[model samples]
Target: MLEAAKAVFITSGVDAPAKEIADLAGVGVGTLYRHFPQRSDLVKAVFQREVDACVAAGPALSANHAPGTALTEWIDRYTEFLATKRGLATALHSGDPALEALPAYFMERVGPTLGALLDAAAASGEIRADVTPRDLLLAVAGLCAPVDHEGAAFSRRMVAFLMDGLRYGAVPPEPRG
Candidate 1:
């Protein structure tokens, strides 16, 4: 049900009706309500699920691919994750105490995972050593912020440029005269 809600939310915004989520989940609205008594409950669940998936991808990606490739792919995935998250930002910041902790939660869950990826790439000499996980994550978030169906290509180009910058000094600079 949370997965269904996530898909619907991506398409229809977090303000999407419960019935729409239930219909997509192939369940009745009552079931959705029974599980999540409040809309915030449902939204929180979807947000947590997305966070978990993005964090888990880091290790799996690193294990399967080269450090540079994994980091690049992970950044792309992180951008996609951020796109979904933007939909939930309003509700997550709605002055509800329960939702108030989410930004910290996001950093806690995602920061170390991204840090590990950054460390791996730097250790492998594939990217610069100066870039911190928080810095890279913020850069990706900024590039992906204005994301829409039309702006996705522009976002990709921006991310690619960021990635190139990350690799700018993978080899030593030429000696100056």
Candidate 2:
């Protein structure tokens, strides 16, 4: 049901009807309601699920791919995850108390995962050691959240540029003495 709701939310916005979600899930509205009694409940659950999935990918990606490749692909996957959040943006800012903790949860879980990725990449000398996970996370989030009517392509291109920057001068900065 959460997966169906996520798809529906991505395609139709968070305001999409519960019936649509229920239909996609092949479940009755009653069933959907039984699990997630409120829209906020459903939204929160879907967001948490997506976050978990994204964070979980980091380890598997590091294990399966080269350090640089894993870092790159994980960021791309993170971009897609960010795209999904576009639909939820409105609801998130609607001052819904239930949704208030989502941003914190996102940072708490995603930050550590990204930190692990960065650490591995730095250890392998695949990227600059000076880069911090929090900085990278904020940078990507800022880039992924398009502005001035910009499209996904622009965000993606900018992210690629950022990745290049990370690769450039892949060494720690000189001491500030």
Candidate 3:
């Protein structure tokens, strides 16, 4: 049901009817309500579900690919997750105390996973060692924000450019002539 809620929230915003999520989940509205009890409850569950999925991807990616490739792929995943997260962000900032812990949860869970990846990439000479995971996370979050007249592709290109900049520092400096 959380998956259904996430899909509906991503496409239709958090105010979308509970029936839509129930239908997508192949359950009755009663079932959804019984589990979540309130719209805020549903929203919180969905957000946590998605965040957990994104965090879980880090280890699988690191295991399957080289450090640089894993980092880039993880960034792409983060971009997609962020794109779907704007609606949830609205819910979190809606003056509801229930939603307050989510931001901290996101940072605490994601920061270390990203740091591990960054550490591997830097140690392997695939990116600069000077970059902190927190800084990179904020930069990506800013880049992922939708700008007027620009779209995801533009943000992606900008992020790719940032990746290229990181790679630049990985290159050894030329010896003085």
| Candidate that scores best on TM-score | 3
Show pairs that collide, candidate 3.
none
Error of 3 at 101 (Å): 0.4
lDDT by residue for model 1 (69-111), tens: 9999999888888778877877887888767877888899999
Candidate 2 colliding pairs: none
**Across residues 83-117, which tens digit of lDDT does each residue of candidate 2 receive?**
88887888888899999999999989999999999
Number of clashes in model 1? 0
Scored against the true structure, residue 46 in model 1 reaches a CA lDDT of: 87
Q: Model 1: residues >4 Å from true position, as ranges?
A: 147-149, 171-177
How does model 3 score by TM-score? Answer: 0.91
Residue 92 lDDT, candidate 1, scale 0-100: 83
Question: Residue 84 CA error for candidate 2 (Å)?
Answer: 0.9
- Candidates 1 and 3 compared: the better one by lDDT is 3
Q: What is the lDDT for 74 in model 1? A: 92
The Cα local distance difference test for each model comes to: 0.87, 0.90, 0.88
Residue-pair clashes per prediction, in order, are 0, 0, 0
